[model samples]
Structures are given as C-alpha cells and as structure tokens.
Target: MESVSTSSVMDILNLLKACCSQSCNYIMTYGGTFSSLASEVGQLKDKSSDVKRDVEAATRDGQTPRSEVLGWLSSVQDMEGEAESIERKYNQKIKCLCSFPLNVCSAYRLRNRAEAALATIRELKQSAEFTKLADNLNLTRSIKMPTTKTIGMDKVFEELQRHAKDDSLSVIGIHGMGGVGKTALLRRFNNDFPSETEADVVIFLELSIDYKLEEVQKSLFDRLSLTWQDEVTHRDRATKLFRVLSTLKFILLLDNLWEPLNYQVVGIPLPAPPSKCKIIFTTRTEDTCSHMGTEKMIKMECLEEEAAWNLFRNSARMDVIDADKNVRIEARDLVKECGGLPAALIVLAQAMAPKKTWEEWMHALTIMKDTPHQLPGMTNNVFSILKLSYDRLSSDNMRVCASYGALFIKGSWIGKFNIRNSWIGEGIIDNVQNVMDADHKTQFLLGILHAASLTVRVHDDYFTMHPMTRAMILWVQRECGKKENKWLVWDRERVEEAPAAEKWRDAERIALVWNQISDLPEAPQCPNLIFLDLQVNKFLRKIPNGFFLHMPLLRILELQETSIEELPVSIGNLMQLHYLNLCKTRITSLPKEMTALVNLKYLSLAFMKYLRIIPDQLISSLRELQWLIMMDSYSGWKEGQSCEGGVSFEELESLKRLKVIGMTVSTLAALQNLCDSPRLAPLTH
Candidate 1:
C-alpha cells in the first residue's frame, strides 16, 4: 500500500478547493468560498427541482449525463482525498484477501467496491485543474510473498519466457492447486520478468473468482493512478475511464480465480487481433484455465527428484563442500534415506544435520519409522518402506540380515533420512569376520552399504537412511540380544515382508544377529538384490543353491550358526558372493564343490562346536577370499586320518592377498610362506 502520503493528500485537497474557486466564477462570479457558497449550492438545489422533471424523464429512459455526475462531485470537498485512501486500502485488502472463494454475494461486494473506485476516479477526473497537474501513474497491487529456489520450476519459467519472447499471445494463465507453487511460481516469474517495456501498464486485480466487470475497472483505475466520483452517473465513470486508457496498453493480471471468465465485466474495451494486451491468472481448477482461453495454460506439477533433493540440501544447509570426510560420508547416507519429497526431505535433513553423531542419527531414523508417513503427495504412508530396503539386499544374504533386526521404537518425530551408519562402526564384520583387506575394510564397507541400498543419495556426498532399516537392526538385536548379551534367546523374525514389484525400498545399513533364529525362509527371486546378513541362526541347517543363482548383486552373506549345518555342494557357486560367515556351526566336512567360489572374500568357520574335515581343493578355488576363520582343535586328530589340507607354500600362490586370518587348523606360513594363520585374530585385528 502507498500509505497515503500527507503531502499528496494535501495537494489533492488544495486542487479540489481551487476547482471550486473556478466553478464559482462560471455560475456565480462573486462568492466567498465553498463554505460561503452553501447558499448558492442551495440555489442550485432549488434549480435541481426544476430540472428534476427533465432529469427524472431521462433517468426513466436510462440516460445519465456527465454534467449530472460533475454536479454531485462539485458539492463534496472533505471526502475527496479520503476517497482515494479508502479505495486504495480496500484494493490492497481485496487483492490480498484471495479471489477464488468469492460466492455470488462476495462477487457483488467486490463489484460494488470496484464500482465505487470507478466513481471516485470519475470524480477526480472531473477536476480539470487536478487533471492538468497530475498525469496519474497507476500502481500495481497484490504484493508477492517470499519464495525459495527449487529446480523443477526452472522448466516452467523457461516455458513462460519462450511465450514472453513470442509476444503473440494476449493472455497467459498459470493454474494449479494451493501450495503447489502456482503463486510462488508467478511471483518468481513477475520478479525476474523482462517484458515490462511492451505494456504501458501492468496491473494486478483480485478477480473475485469471477470477473465482475466493475472489479476489473477498479483494479485498472487503481493501477492508472486514476480516481472516480464517490457518487456519480455511470456514463461519467465510463467516459473518464476511456479518456484515461485511450493512449495506453496494459497487461492485466486476473489472479486467484475459481469461476468462468468474462473480460467485459471489468468494463475494459476489448481489443481486436494483436490486442497488444494481456491478462494472466492463477487458479486451482483446470476449468478456470480453459474458460479463460489462456494462450499458454500452464499447470503446475510437483518437483521431481533432483529438485526435491536440492530443496532438501539447501534447506538443511548441507552443502557437501564444507563437510569433513567422515561427516560428508554421513551426510551422503542421510540424504539417501529421505526420498525426494520436498517437505519431508527438508524436515528430515535439517533435523539430522545438527546432530552429527551416529547415535543421534540412529535415534532419528527409529523415530521416523514408527511415526506416520506424511511425506510428499500423501500418496502412501511408509508401510513397506522397510521391506523395500530388505528386497534390495542380495538373495543369499536376505534371511541372515533380516533375522538380525533391532528392537523397534516409536517416537514424536521420525524421518527415515536422519540415520547414518558407518558400515565399519555398525559391527557388520563380527557376523562376517572372514572378509577384510588389511588396508581399507572400512571404506569398502561403506561402498558395499551404498551398493546394497542400505544408504541412498541426497547430493554428491550426502545420503539418507530409512528408519525401517534401524527398526530391522533393532529387531534383530532384540532377538539375538546384544553382541555382549550372549545368554539371551534370539527368536523374533527380523524381516516380516518383502517388497512387491511396485514399492519403495528402505535404504538403511544393517548387520546380522543370527544367534536370534532357528530357521531360514525360502530363497528370494529378486535379481537386483545386494547384501545378505545371516550370521547366527543356531538351528539353520540347509542353504538353497538357487539362493545366489539369480541375485548377481549378492555381496555379503553372514551365517554364524554353522554348528547346525552341512554345506550343499552348491555353496561354492555363489560367484558374486563377497562375505561368507559360517561361524560356530557343525559341519563334518568341507565339500570339494567349494572350489567354485572364486569371488569369495570372507569365509568364517570359527568357533565351531565340533570338529570338521576340510577339502584341500576348497582352498585352491577361493582365489578372492580375503579373511578366513576356522576352529583348530576340533580337526579330530585320529591316527591315520586323511587330512583335507596339506598343500605346500609353493602351490598357494593365490594366498598372497590374504590379510586377517581367524583359523584353527590351516597354517598360512606353511601354505603362503607367511607366519602361521592365527588361531584367532586379535580382538582389534
């Protein structure tokens, strides 16, 4: 609002007084002032009775003259300046009040106000002296609200810019639902716009859901810096408007509408082809867009993934550049967890960044899991989110990791994106102690985590973790008890359901707690699966060969309760398998079929409750297996017993890559010329 400057008001008042002075010369050349002319005004009133007959006859015939309007306006002095202020105040209010919800009665009220503004404009125009001094620069109304930068709207703006360049259209309307960024989009468009030179006037009118002609006129007059008579003949207002706009072109904004369009309702002249004018509007209804005959009827849709992620990163203040290496890794995991819903991504990213510790991250994820999913689109609550993540894991490792779920927790605010886990820090290896390159196990772990969909991306280095992952982790922990809680009975199912073809996966890193269950489910069929954590299912006996046949992405398999086991000759066929755990189980002998496990990285056979025979050929085929674990004394040292491993160092050339060894029988020095393999690796080792 202009705030109605005191000087401007005073000047308008003085001009009104001066007009009265000159008017005194025409009718009664001798007069004191407007106050003194009260008597003369009475005389005019007396004359009005005589003309009343003629005026009444014309009024009955629907004819009103400019002279009649001027005569009425001439009598008013105190209210002239006040009228301008009043019109402006309401224009600002109506413009800001929103135009879409106007029912028929509201339309009338707005129409009346616009008519009143037109009357005020007409009255002000009758003042010849004021008109001579003031060209009347109209001000546009309906200020824009603050906006944020997101990616997807760039395409919308570019489309509009192309239209602006074409300059062939007379009108453009951007239509969409509330809070979907229509207004924000328009405001951004208007602010960065470069087409102002084409129109003499750019005016914004609150179209009152339906275009009542008068409201349009008022908005136009307000923009033109024109005023009208408070009480006037309609012809006078119309004439004044024509006189003002005859030389100018205008771009009118008929915004926030919900009803059908009719331009004439605004009392503006309809221009012929190449009208060189425009009327743009915004509305939630498509019908509104079509009825207006907008040249470019643009509908606003939701931001896509990249846009959502950018919005989240920007909102969370998580620019990857400033983060340290460790923190950057954590941030990457964080963004991946919060899928690209604009609101949820931002809310979650902001909440997680302040607390950089893994502990806090875990807490946040747990919270989001149990909380209702109210993220973008409100399409689906996070029902199968955990299952989605579970589905992404490699087939052979599914039950292993699923059974290790942690205890579930519900809380006030939950965001799947808030959790971050360092694959190393999460103790994933204790379940798969057989696989580790001495130099970079931690970094490798993090990579494996991302590949497994346990973590997802937000930015280059920022990631997010789903809460269900933590819930899975917690469920497994509760089942198996803590690593420190050795005496607890682990029984609850870690994973309840797998994902259907159409669903989102929870991408949170997890570890195995195989000490928790006694059985494994049927193998899965997902080809894109990755990690498998089945470290300690004490009653687990058979592992299906088909487990790894289809899941080419299989990475880690943790099966610790090997005591209740026998390896199918097919166990060696998991070519893509990286980490394998057979910790503390009973196997009478290693199968020669194990020679086919060329990609095997970690093989854990430590803490076996009973002795087991080994197949020497198994060692030769495990060219990539890095870490090895086995119990020693249980080798069953019977006289004349056939030993499965007696290979010389010369034949163990493939053992050069070996690093950490958890073994009971196989001697690495005798095999690889290194010192004997450890009976058990150091706790830190």
Candidate 2:
C-alpha cells in the first residue's frame, strides 16, 4: 500500500497556521467585514475534519481510482504551498518598506502573487469533491461556562448542596440582610450545580422590586426562544408560557426577590411531586421565602473578622508586608466598621484604594465614624455604608441627580428620559440651553451613579435605586432640610387631603401620586414650588381657585387619573409651566385662561373620554408647545355648536415649534391646511 506524502502533510499544517494568522491580522486591521467571502472561508475551515476523514477512508478502502484521488490531493497541497509563499513574501516586503521609501517593483510583485493565490483558493473551493466534503461535515459551536469563586460561605454552600440532593426538597430559600453576599453565594451555587447534577435546563432571573408580570413573561419567552404574537394579552402569554414550562424538567433560580412571587401568576408551573426539578430563591427576609413556600431555608451570615479583613485587603490592594504598623491598624479598624458585610467592605475598600497615605486613610475613617448610622426612615445599617459611597461622588451634580432619583417610590422603576425631562422642568440642570444639552447632562450623571454602584440598571432605558441607596438618599434630603428640597409621598400612602399652606411654603418639588387624596387644601403660599405631581388621585374633586395664584414659578403639574371636573380660571398664572399632564381626567373643557402659558412645551390630554372640547385658541396660543398628546379625546364635536370649544387645526400652524402630535383621524384633519407648511414638516409620530 502507498503512504501519503510527508511533504503534503507539512504543507497542509503550515497553510492552516498561515490562514489563522492572516484571519486574525485582517480582523484587527479592517474589523469584521461580514462579507460572503469571509463566511465561505469560515465554512471551509469547519469542513477540514470531514475532508481529512474522507481521504483516510478512501486510502484504506483502496477501491476507487487512486490516480484521480491523488491528483486532487496534490493540487490542494500545491495551492496551499503557493499561498503560504505569497503571504510570507508580502509580509517581508511590508516590514522592509515601513522605514524606507516604497519599492514599487517589490510591492507590485507581492500584490500579483496575492491575487494569484486567492484565485487558486477560489478554484479549489469550487471543486465538486470539496463541496461534497463540506456538505458532509456537521459543525458545532461551543460556549465556555463562566468561572465563579466565592470568597467565603463554604458551610452555606454545603448545606445548599445537601438540600439539593434531597429528592423531597423542591424549593430552597437563601435569605440574608442586604450586602451580606446573598447574591454571590447564589451565583456560585448556580455555576456549580450543572456539574454536580443532571438537569434539562437552568434559568436565572433577577427579579427587581418593580418587575411587571409582562416583563417577566417576556424575559422567559426570550430565554426559551418561544415565539409570542404581537399585542397578546397577559393571560394569553401566561397560558402559552405555562404550556412550555410544564413539559420541561428544569431548575429555576430567581434572585433579588423583594416580595413573595406567585409562580402561577408569573406563568411558572408547580413541580410535580415525583419530579427532580427544583426551585431556588434569594431575598433579604426569610418571611418572603416562607411566603413563597420554600421547603428549606438557608440563612446567609456576614463574614468572620479574619475573612472580612482578608477580603478588604485584597480589594483595596493593600500590601500588609510593606505597610507601616499604624496604616495596618487603621485599615483593620475600618474593616470592622464594615460590619462584616462583604459588599460594604469591597465598596469601602475600592473607594479608599487610591489613598495610599495613613493620613488619607485616617480621614476616611474619621468621616465614617462621624457620619450618622441611623437614617430617619430606615432601620438598617446598610444605608450608613451606602451613604459613605454617595458622599464620595465626583460632583454635586452627581449627588443631586442620585438623591433626586430617590424621590421615586422605593421599588419603582424610573425611565432615564422621563427623569431628564423632570430635571429640566424643575430647573435643576444648569446652563442647559436646550433639551439636547439637558439630555446629555442627564446621561452623564446616570453613568456616574451606575459606576459608583449607587443605582442598578433595570432595562435599557430604565433603572431602579437600591433600597439601601434609596434610604440613604432620603437621609441626604433630611440632612439638607426637606422643607427646602423635595418631598415625595407615593404608592400606598393614604392622604385624605393635601398639605396645609405652610407645609408647602418652602417646598421646591412635591409628589403625592397614587394616593387617595380627595381635595387640595389652599396652597397659596407655595411660592417656591416648581414641580407638583398629584397623579392617580381618583378622588381629587377640586382645587382652590387661589392655588395657582402663588405658584408663579411652577414648571410641571401632573394631575392625571383625577376626578377634577374643571380647571380654575387662574390656571393662566403658571406662565413658567413647561409640562402639563391632565390625561384620563374628567374635565369637559380647558379654561381659556390656560392659553396664557407661553412656556408650555408638553401637554397631555390623552384618554379624556369625557372631553368634548379644547378651548379654540388654547393649543395655538402656546408658541413653544413641542409635544401635544390628545389621542382618544375630543370626539364629540358638533357642526352647529360654537367654535369656542372646538380647536381649529389650521390655527395650530402658528405653533412652529411643535414636534410631536398624538391625535386620532378626526383631530388630524386639523393639520390639512398645514400640510404644505415647512414649519410643521418635522412632526414625529
């Protein structure tokens, strides 16, 4: 039997190495091209194994035409040898030409050789035998698993493993205080479980406090690669999700549970009694785990003193071998102040990492000692540590932005765009000449907060403040004196009536949303107020006529989902108001006096089913109006009625700055006359 040529084997190996090196160099020099040629090369590389296997089988069988097979093999080897020679020559020419004048002859020769080599490769790929070998190969891509190493908590992990091994234990709970490393331990467990047990699937989800049912369903659908129809109702989605999950034997791991989650509501089916599937969850309170029906509870404790110091030293990059005795002593004391909490220790260490001197370390220690441990509204020490990080923010703008984020409900999600608008409305952003500038500044501030770990990203355009960070922000507000800043009362807070006049005297921004307030007390003394949110107060029946008289500086007023029947004639007094939200209200018509708000930029009257009219010149009079939301409203217009309550769309052409208009077909007819107007050409859907 004839053996394969040794030179051919060597040529093939060299060609493979050269191709890999060239591919890397091309990617680095030109980035990814994603062209068809590149894709074909990738497929050829994947088929190399099949090509070798087929050649081996042919040689062993010795049944086919040896001359034809050997001829094809020799051609491939010759092409690879020529390609390698061309690449080497080109690279050598490039190196020699880098420091001297270009050699035109050498450059032209190298380019010709490269083109000839490429042509040969194309010819080889087009061969019928090569194509058949490529078709016979089954290529698979492998993803590397993430590596996880927890610093402490071996005992807890052992207990968790024990519970997981027990076939009777379907649900296991891990609960601990904030910053105690509950998340880290859970992550370790997740990473190690697949190696220890056989499970069909493992799904990990971080359930923020404000996670909506739809959001959870969407996440599951995406992870499972299931198709969902557009505009499907929540119940339909839930049913579809249930049908999929009920058939799989899977392990579900949920983290950061703020409240007990109902599996059925979230479309997760209960595991059958004899199944090996398990469910695990982590939360701050054991009671929540109990409420979720966990069969076994694993409580996570803070690190020991020795382990705490070790972790802190590692994170801070502090070298004990070279440090002075005094610096070491102070560092140990600071670690103790962290209260054995891994998160606090790491953050504090990182914050102090750049300060190498003992004096800087002592100063940080003194500040921590002097700072109050107790926040007015919270009973946890987590805020004390979080405030330390907050105080270290780079600028006052960053601090203000972070503190302002806390004005939202404890677990509420805040949209980045909405918050930026609110900041502009309240005049918090300085030197912001236009909306674009304000948005840039807002994004910068949010980036700073995220880097400092003061806020957690919830989605692409939204974020949620950590509960401890929220508490610290409230403490900052109280420290600044709430009377001079923001005061928020929202979500489940029941207030029968608005604050007294004196209570609003020094307030700059007040939010009383999602409450049961029935009436607004006379607030004629709120001269410094800038933002007032009274949204979702269904029982709010009336506002005093004098309420707007003193708030001349007000910029944003939200009264959506209210029962108010009419606006006071004095509403025109808010000349500084830029945003007005009266959506879903029962108001029949806007007061003509509101036409005097020249600075109004955003006006929302959407879903006002009872709204029959908008005062004739009310919208056209606001020269700066940019966003006008009037969809699903004003459908009761009569041909014979007075035009006083009807808006003339032609008149809207005068408001040249309008950028967005949400209206129905009946209302869009108003823009017929303005269709040719260049000023209205930039309107967005």
User: Could you tell me every candidate's TM-score relative to the true structure?
Assistant: 0.33, 0.44
lDDT per residue as tens, model 1, 1-685 = 3556877898999999998666434324211222223343344445444455544533432234346344544444333443445444444543223232224344345444445544544444444232121222333423453555544578887886676555578677786433345555666766665654566655655555335555666666556655544575545556556555544566566666766666544455544447666667777555556677767787665566567556656776644425456555555554455444343455566565567565655555544543323223221322232334444444533433332223212111212211111121123433343333322443443344444444433444344443434434443433322332211222234532322322212212223343444444344453544545554555556665554454555555655653455776556556677666666667767778777778776666667655456655556577775566554523332212243344432223355455555444344333333333233224113
Candidate 2 structure quality by residue, lDDT tens digits, 1-685: 1346877888899999998687545433321221333454444444444566666643332213245445555666676666557555544653332233145555545555555656666766666263222111111111123532356678888888788777788888887666777777777777777454656567777786567888788777766656656698888778777766665566788887766888888788877556678888987655577788888888776688898887777765766415778877888887776657687677776677777788977887775543423312222435654565577666776676787676677667899977875665555554444446657888777766764557766786899875546656665665533333345445547777776667787676788888889877664577777778898888887887877888988999988898998998879899999888889999997898988999988788889888876767677899987777777876533222245445555556687766666665353434443354455534523
Cand. 1 TM to true fold: 0.33
For each of the candidates, the C-alpha root-mean-square deviation to the true structure, in angstroms, is 25.2, 25.1
Q: Candidate 1, after superposition: displacement of residue 653 in Å? A: 82
Cα error of candidate 2 at position 152, Å: 7.2
Window of ten residues with lowest summed lDDT in model 2 = 134-143
The candidate that achieves the highest lDDT relative to the unseen native structure: 2
Write down the TM-score for model 2: 0.44
In angstroms, the error of model 2 at 462 is 3.6
Stretches off by above 4 angstroms in model 2 are 1-385, 388-400, 415-421, 427-448, 480-488, 635-645, 667-678
- Candidate 1's C-alpha runs over 4 A off are 1-145, 150-152, 176-178, 205-221, 228-247, 268-272, 319-355, 358-685
